[model samples]
Target: GMADETILLADDDPMIVDPLALQLRREGFTVHIAVDGEDALAQARRVTPDVVLLDIMMPKKQGWEVCRELRAESDVPIIMLTARGEEMDRILGLELGADDYLTKPFSARELIARIRAVLRRVAMDSARQASPAAETASDDDVVQLGRVTVDRARYQVAVDGEPVHLSQREYSLLMALLDAQGAAVKRGDL
Candidate 1:
C-alpha cells in the first residue's frame, strides 16, 4: 500500500512543494522534499524513495541533469513535472527515462493516478523477475549439458525431449550445483 511507500519530491517552489507534500502525506505516503538537484540526489540516495516527482526546472542542478544522473544509477520510477508543455520538452523528458510526464497545472487526480500507475508497473516488473519462467522459452532461457537440457524458467530438466522428474531436494541440489559452475560445494554448506 502507499502507506508504506515513500516519495522524493524535488522542486524549487515552496508553493508547489508544500501543498503537494501535504496532499501526498494525507494520502498516506512518506514524502521527502528537495529544493534543488543536489538535494534531490542526496535525499534520493539516502531515502531510496519508491518514486520521484521531479520538477523540470530546479536550481543547483537542472531537472534534466538530475533525471539523467538518477537514471544512470537507479530504476526508481520518476514522474517529471514541467511548466513547458511543448512536445519537444515532453519527448526529451521521456527519452531521459522518466516513467511519466506531468504538465504544470495538471489535475491533482491525474498526478495521483500517474504515481499509482508507475508504482504498479514497477511492482509488476519485480513480480516477473521473481516468478519462474515456463518451459516454452526462447534460446536464451535453456541450457544444455550434453544430452540433458535445463529449462530455467520452468525449473525442469529433460533428456532426449523426455522430462526428468525431480524431488524438491533434488531440484534444490541441482540448482546449487548449477550455481557452482562445476566447482565442488561442501555438503555442510548446502
Candidate 2:
C-alpha cells in the first residue's frame, strides 16, 4: 500500500524535476518542487514534507549547506541527488545528515523504492521513541520498549507487531543500550 506522503524535490534542472514530480504524484504522493537551494529551504519550512530529494548543484546555495540547515531544524529524511557518482561524494552526503544518496540517471522505480525504504525506517524509529518508559524485559530474553520488541532467543525485532529488519551493527548497538538499562553507554564501548 502506498502511504499518502508529501515529497519536496529540489533541483535546478527542469528536465529532472518535471518528470520526477509527475511520477511521484502518480504514485499518490503530494509533490512540491524547488528550483534552487534557497527555494528548497523555504519550501521545506513552509510545507514540512515527509521526504526531501535534494540536488547537489544549484544557484544561490549548495545542497550540502541546505542539508545541514535542514538537519539542524528537524529529522526530516533527505536524499542527496548528484550527477557525480564518486565514493567521496556519497560519503560526504551521508556525513552531512542525508539518509540516502542517488547518482543521476537512476530509474524512477529505483528512486521510488529507496523513498519507501527510508520512510519505513523513519516510521519505525518514531514508534520506538513513543514511550521509552514502558520498556520491559522477561527472563525468556524478550525485551519490549514502547512499540518495539526484541526477542534475543530468536534474534528478532518488531515494531507494532511488524518485523523490523536491522543491520548487524544496529542490532549490536541496540543490545548495548538495552544492557545499559537507561544509563548512558559510552560511545567507545559500542
Candidate 2 Cα errors over 4 Å, as ranges: 133-190
Candidate 2 worst ten-residue window by lDDT: 131-140
- lDDT scores of the candidates, listed in order: 0.86, 0.90
TM-score of candidate 2 against the unseen true structure: 0.71
N/CA/C clash count, model 2: 0
- Any idea what lDDT model 2 has? 0.90
- Give the TM-score of each candidate: 0.70, 0.71
The per-prediction tally of clashing pairs is 1, 0
Measured by lDDT, the strongest candidate is: 2
Q: After superposition, how far is residue 133 of candidate 1 from its true place, in Å?
A: 1.3
Off by over 4 Å in 1: 134-190
Candidate 2 lDDT by residue in tens digits, 77-187: 999999999899899999999999999999888999999999998887666557563344334478877798899888899999999999999999998888777788898
Whole-model lDDT, model 1: 0.86
